[model samples]
Structure formats: structure tokens, C-alpha cells
Target: MKILLDFVPLVLFFIAYKLYGIYAGTAVLMGATVVQMAIIYFMDKKLSAMHKATLALILIFGALTLILKDDRFIKWKPTVLYAAMAVALAVALWGFGKNFLKMMLGNQITLPENVWVRLNTIWVVYCLFMAAINGYVAAYYSTDAWASFKLWGYVFPLAFIIGQGFYVARHIVDDTDKPAEPPGDVQ
Candidate 1:
């Protein structure tokens, strides 16, 4: 359900684009994003920083595309977003000696500090790669091609996540795997 909610805006944008055009798609995307966020807020009672950032970018870039009558603004949004994420993660991890991935998910999943660092590093690299690829397609390709890529590019993240899941699973600590305390000898 949450995944579907997250994707509603993108699917709507694509359908709108196919039925109308980029401008219409942008408008629909903006509206759908707002609706999506509203629903998420209602359900979760809070929004993640990522959600807020994504909403802001969609609205800002969508408005720019509509107002200027140029599709470039909308097309470049993903590149800007991915690049921003990569820079944020890299600077936080290397410059400030912070692991943001661990900060966000530490409570939910336990892993060794080294694993957290490696995960954060992987995220930074992945974001940069995604940013570069999107920028390349957006810059060098036609709008139609770019739109198609936007839809098909879902594969990259899906694969990345599945691979990450398998990697993380190997490192996940299972309480059941630990030796039980003998009788009442709790330590």
C-alpha cells in the first residue's frame, strides 16, 4: 500500500504525458504529488525528510516547467535531486564523520559499524551513478526518449534495492541465532 502510494504520482505523470503532453504531465505530477504527500501525512502522521525534499523538488521544478514552457526544468529535477542526495551523504559521512543511513535505520536494523559505513558509502556511489545517468539521458535524448527512460529507469533502483537487501540480510543479526542463557543465569 505504501509503495503504491509512493508510485501513484509517477504513474499518473506518465499516463498524463501519454494522453496529453509534458506540461499536462507536469501539472498532473504536481497535483498527484501533493495528494500523495497528504495521504502519507494522514496515514503516518509525519513525513520523512526525503519525502519533504521530493515534494519540494517536484513542485518547484514542475512549476518552473509550466511557467517557462520548457521541459528541461522537470527533466533535470531527478539529476539535481540525486546529486544533492549523493553530496549530502558523502559530506556527512566523510567530512563530518557521520553515517546518515545508520542514523535513520539504526533503530530498525542492527548492523556492525563497518557495515553501516559501507552501506552509506554504497548509497553515495549509487546516488552519483543515478544522477549521472539521468543527467546524460535528459541532456542528450529527446523528450519522448527521456520520458520512456524515466519509466524504464525504475529497473535500476529495483535491482539496487534487491541486491542491497541480499547483502544486508547476510549481515543481519538474528536473536534466535544467539545462544540462550542457561536456566536463570541472565547476563
Candidate 2:
């Protein structure tokens, strides 16, 4: 279920683009985003891990991009969101010496403070890199090309990241009642 949910963004975008070019797909993507948000909103009481607000914001901005019929909006959406996230993570680590990421996934795994800090930095930079890569493909490639990359380009890297994260978590997990460290925070 988590894996499928992870692919929601790319899956919806691809289906949208295939059914209706960029414009129509943009609208469909926006609509689907709203539906996803609605699901989270209604399920919040039942589901503990869902992020409703993020889904809502995505739908809102995605809809605006579609209604305005400007490709730039869709293109910039992920770029800005991701880049801003990277900067925020970097700032948090540098200024506060806190590990926000650990907070998010700390319950699931145990890690040390220093390790969490390093992982946070790496993941944040990775997101920024993804944002840059998204922008580059959108600019140089066709819509189909970009859409395909969005759906497929991430598969291997994501697989690696998850595998690595789990591996690290399992290794660092303490058996006794030790305090958890922060993780690399992400949306």
C-alpha cells in the first residue's frame, strides 16, 4: 500500500497526459490530487500516517496550473517545492542542530543523532537534485518524455533509497529502551 501510494503522483500524471495531452492531463492531475486529499481528510480518523494538508496543497496548485493553461505552473510546482524543502532542511540542521527527519520516522526505527543529521542532509540534497532533474527534463524533453521519466526514472533510485534506509535503520535499531534520534524530514 505504501509503495502504491508513493507512486500516486507519477501514476496520475501519466494517466492524465495519456488521456488528454498536457492541458487535459494537467486538469485530471489536479482533480485526482483533490480526490487524494479528500481521501486523507476523511480517513484521518482511521489512518494515522496520512498527510492531508500536503495533498490538499498539491491539488490546489495543480488545479491552478490546469485552469490557467500554463505549462510553467506545473513545471515550477515540483521544482519550487523541492528546492525550498532542501533549503529548509539545510537551514534546520545548520541553525538548530535538530533532526526533523528523525522526528517523522523515529517511531519506526532507531538511529543516533549524528547519523540522523547526516542522513537528513543527504536526503534533502537528493530532493533538490530531483527537482533540478525534473526541471531539466521538462525543459529539454517532450511532454511525453518528461512524463515517462517522472514515472519510470525514479523507480531504481527510489528502490535504492528505501532499501538503504531500511538497511541502515535495521542496523542501528537498539533493542533496549533508548531514546530515538531524529530522521531526515521530508514530505
Candidate 3:
């Protein structure tokens, strides 16, 4: 359900682009994003920082695309978002000595400190790679080509997530396997 909600705006944008054009598609994207956020807020009763940032970027860039009559803004939005994520992850881990990925997920799963560090590093690198690829496509490709890439580019994230899941699964501890402690009153 959450994943479907997350993809609604992108799917709508692609459909709108196919029927109308960039400008109309931008408008649809912006509206769909707003609706998506509202539903999420109602469901969760709050929004994560990432959710807020994504909403803001979509509205800002989508508006610019429509108002300025430039498809470049929409095309470049993903690059900007991904680059910012990379910078934030890197700075939080190195400059501040904080592992944000761990902070966010530590409650749900426990892993060795070393594994946490490696995961954070992997996230930073992955974000940078995504940003670079999106930047390359947005810079060098036609609008139609970029649109197609936008829809198909989901493959990268899906693969990365499945791979990450496999990696993390190996490290997850199963408490059920531990032996029970002896009673304190044992003779």
C-alpha cells in the first residue's frame, strides 16, 4: 500500500506526459504529489523529513517547470534530490559522527556497529551514483527519452533494495536460537 502510494505521482506524471506534454504533466505531478502527501499524513499522522523534503522539491521544481516553460527543471529534479541525499548522509556520518540510517532503522533491527557503518557508507555511495546517472541522462537526453528513463529507471532502486535486503538478512540475529538462562535457585 505504501509503495503504491509512493509511485502514484510518478505514474500519473508519465501518463499525463503521454497524453498531453511536459507542462500538463508537471501540473499533474505536482497535484498528485500533494494528494499523496495528504494521504500519507492522514495515515501516519505525521511525515518523515524525507517525505517533507520530497514534497517540497516536487512542488518547487514542478512549478518552475510549468511557469518557466522548461522541461529541464522537472528532468533535473531527481538529480538534485539524490545529490542532496548523498551529501546529507555523508555529512551526518563523517562530519557529525552520526549514522542517520542507523538512527532511523536501529529500533527495528539490531546489527553490529561495523555493519551499521558499512550500511551507511553503502547508502551514501548509492545515492551519489544515482545522482550522477540521473544528471547524465537529464543533461544529455531528449525530453521524451528522459521521460522513458524516468519510468524505467525504477529498476535501479528495486534491484538495489533487493540486494540490500539480502545483505542485511545475513546479519539479522535470531533471538530464538539462544539458550535459556538457568534459574537463580539452582542447587
Candidate 4:
């Protein structure tokens, strides 16, 4: 259900672009994103920082696209968002000595500190690559081509996530296999 909600706005944007154009697609994307956020908030009673950032970007870039009658702003939105994420991850990992990715996932998955650092590095590199590729496509391609890329480009993140899953799988603790401690024993 959450995954479906996440894709709703992107799917709507693609369909609207195919049927109408960039402007209509932008408007639909904005509305769909707002609806998605509202649903998430109502269901979860809160929003993650990532969700808020994405919502803010869509609103800002979508409004610019609509008001200025220019699609470039909307086209650049993904690149900007990705770049910002890359920077944030880099800063948190290096400057602040924090592995945010690990901080978020550590409770659920147990891995060595080194593994977490490697994971954080992978995320930073992935985000930078995504941002660069998106900017390149948006700058070098036609609007129609860019629109197609926007839809098809989802493969990148999907592939990245699958790869990450594989990498993390090897490190996930199998608590079931551990010997049970004596009842009421403290350690």
C-alpha cells in the first residue's frame, strides 16, 4: 500500500504527460503528490524528512513550471533533490561523523560499523550518479525524450534498491539461530 502510494504521483505524471503535456503533467504531479502526502500523514500521523523534502520540491518546482510557463524548472527538480541528498549524506558521514543511513536502519538490521560506513558511501555515490544523469538527460534531451526518461529512469533506483538488498542480506543478523539465553538471566 505504501509503495503504491509512492508511485501514484509518478505514474500520474507520466500518463498526464503522454495525454496532455508537461504543464498538465506538472499540475497533476503536484496534486497527486499532495494527496499522497496527506494520505501518508493521516495513516502514519507524521511525515519523514525525506517525504517532506520531496513534497516541498514538487510544490516549488511545479509552481515555477506553472507560473513561468517553463518546464525546465520541473525538469531540474529531480536533479536538485538528488544532489541535495548526496550532499547531505556526505556531510553527515564525513563532516559530522554520522552514518545517517545506518542510524535509520541500525535498529532493524545489525551490521558492523564498517559495513554501515560502506553502505553510507554507496548511498552518497548512488545519489551523486543519479543527480548527474538526471541533469544530463534533462539538459541534452528534448522535452519528449526527457519525459520518457523520467518514466523509464525509475529503473535506476529500483536496481539500486535490489542491489542494496543483496548487499545487506549478507550482513543481516539471524537471531533465530542464536542459542536462547537462560530465562531471567541479565547480561
Candidate 5:
């Protein structure tokens, strides 16, 4: 359900683009994003920082696209967003000596600190690569090509997630498989 909600705005945008054009698609995207945020707030009672950042970017770029009558603003949104994420992750990891990804998922998954660092590094690299690719495609390609890439580009994240799952799985401990220690052994 959460995954579907996350995708609602993108799906609507795609459909609107196919049926009408970029302007109509942009409008639909803005409206759908608002609806998505509202639903998330109602259900979760709070929004994550990532959600707020996404909402802000969507509104800002969507507004620029509509008001200025230039599709370039919208085209550049994804690149900006991906670049921002990469920078944030890099700063958090290297500058602050903190692994934000591990902080977020540490409770659910246990791994050595080195493994966590590796995972964070992988994400930083992935985000940077995604930003570069999006920028290149948006700048060099036609609008139709960019839109097609937008839809097909989902494969990258999907593949990354599957690979992440496999990587994390190798390090996860199955508590159920271990014999219980005596009460006095608790520490």
C-alpha cells in the first residue's frame, strides 16, 4: 500500500502526459502529489524528511514549469533531487562520520559497522550516478525521450533494491536459529 501510494503521482503524470501533454501532465502531477501527501499524513500522522523534501521540490519545479511555460524546469527536477540526495548522504557519512542509512535501518537489520559503511557508500555512489544520468538524458534528449526514460529508469532503483536485499541477507542473523543462552549469560 505504501509503495502504491508512492507511485500514484508518477503513474498519474504518465497517463496525463499520454492523454494530453506536458502541461496537463504537470498539473496532474502537482494535484496527485498533494493528494499523496494528504493521504500519507492522514495515515501515518507524520511525514518523513524525505517526503517533505520531495513535496517541496515537486511544488517548486512544477510551479516553475507551469508559470514560466517551460518544460525544462520539470525536466531538471529529477536531476536536482538526485544530486541533493547524493550530497546529503555524502555529508552525513564523511563530514559528520555518521551513516544515515544505517541509522534508519539499524533497528531492523544487524550488520558490522564496516558493512554499514559499505552500504552507505554504495547508496552515495548510486545516487550520484542516477543524478548524472538524469541530467545527461534531460539535457541531450527530446521531451518524449526524457519521459520514456523517466518511466524506464525505475528499473535502476528496482535492481539496486534487489541487489541490496541480497547483500543485506548475507549479513543478517537469524535469531530463531540460535539456541537460547542461560539467564545468567545475558549481558
Candidate 6:
């Protein structure tokens, strides 16, 4: 549900571009971004956390693209946002002594610290790849193709992540040295 909210603007942008034009879609995404941020601020705990900063950037640059009436600007937004997120994740992992990935997803599965770092690196590299892919599509592909990719390209990665979660969960060591499982429920 929350993931869909994060994706709403991109979806809208794509649809608008298909029906109207780049500028029109940009306008729609801009409005959606404002709404997204408002939800992030007001509904942090109840709904979803605020990791849509990259999406917000997309919206802003989309607006700039509309106002400037240049497709290049809008095309650049995703690349910049993706690269920026990659850097931010790397910094959080190593330099800032933070573990954002863990915060976002650790509790559900457990793994070694090294695995976490490697996964973190994978995430950064993945973002970079995403940026490049977006650029390629925007520059060479038709708007319809770009929008289709935008809508569907997310599935493989999401499925990969979910599978990795299961793999990691299977390997977790119950090293707390207590009962094999938490209290309550059937034996």
C-alpha cells in the first residue's frame, strides 16, 4: 500500500505523458510530490516512512523541465536522483556510521555484518544502474516505451529482494542462547 503511494507520482507522470505531453505529466507529478511529502510528514508511523526523497527530486526537476520546456532537464532528474541516493546510502553505511538499510529492512531477516555491507554496496550500484537505464530510455526510447519500463521494471528487483529476505531468514542463527523460538504459541 505504502509502496504504491511512493510510486503514485511516477505512475501519474507516465500516464500524463502518454495522454497529454511531457510538460503536462510534469505538472501532475509536481502536484503529486507535494501531496506525497505531506503524507510523509503527517503519517510516518501509521502508514509509511519517508524514503521518497528521490521521488520528490523527480517531481521538482519535472517541474523545471515543464517550465523550461526542455525534455533534457526532465530526463536528467532520475539520473541525478538515483546517483544522489547511491551516494547517500554509501555515506550512511560507512562514513556516517549509520545503517539505513538495516533500519528499513533488518528486523524481518538477519544476516552477517559483511552481508549487510555487501548488500548496501549492491543497493548503491543498483541505483547507479537505474539512473543509467532511465537516461537510456528517456534519450533513445519513445515516451510510451519509457513509461512502460517505468511501470514494469520495478518487479524484478522487488521479487529479488523478497527472495533474498527468505534466504537470509533461513540462515539466521538463533544465537541468543535461549529457546529456539520466541515465547507464546504452539510448540
Query: Clashes in model 6: which pairs?
Result: none
Cα lDDT over the full model 1 = 0.93
Q: List the residue pairs that clash in candidate 3.
A: none
In model 2, where do residues sit more than 4 Å from their true spots? Answer: 41-57, 177-187
What's the CA error at residue 145 for candidate 2, in Å?
1.6
lDDT of 4 by residue, 104-151 (tens): 778888987888999999999999999999999999999889988988
Measured with C-alpha atoms, the lDDT of residue 41 in candidate 4 is 99
Cα error, candidate 6, residue 7 (Å): 2.7
Give the residue spans of candidate 4 off by over 4 A. Answer: 176-187
lDDT string for model 3 (38-151, tens) is: 999999999988899999999999989988999899999999998999999999999999999899899888888888999999999999999999999999999998988988
- Per-residue lDDT tens digits for candidate 2, residues 1-187, read 6456556756877887888787777776776666665665576544333244345556666767777877766766666667867777788788887666877778877777777887887878787887898889878887778778777887755775886667576658665766677888878
TM-score of each: 0.93, 0.78, 0.92, 0.92, 0.90, 0.74
Number of clashing residue pairs in every model?
Answer: 0, 5, 0, 0, 0, 0
lDDT by residue (tens digit), candidate 5, 113-150: 89899999999899899999999999999988888788
User: Which residue pairs show backbone clashes in model 1?
Assistant: none
Candidate 1's displacement at residue 86, Å, is: 0.4
Give the TM-score ranking, best first.
1, 3, 4, 5, 2, 6
**lDDT (Cα, 0-100) at 100 in candidate 3:** 92
Query: Residue 167 of model 6: what lDDT?
Result: 60
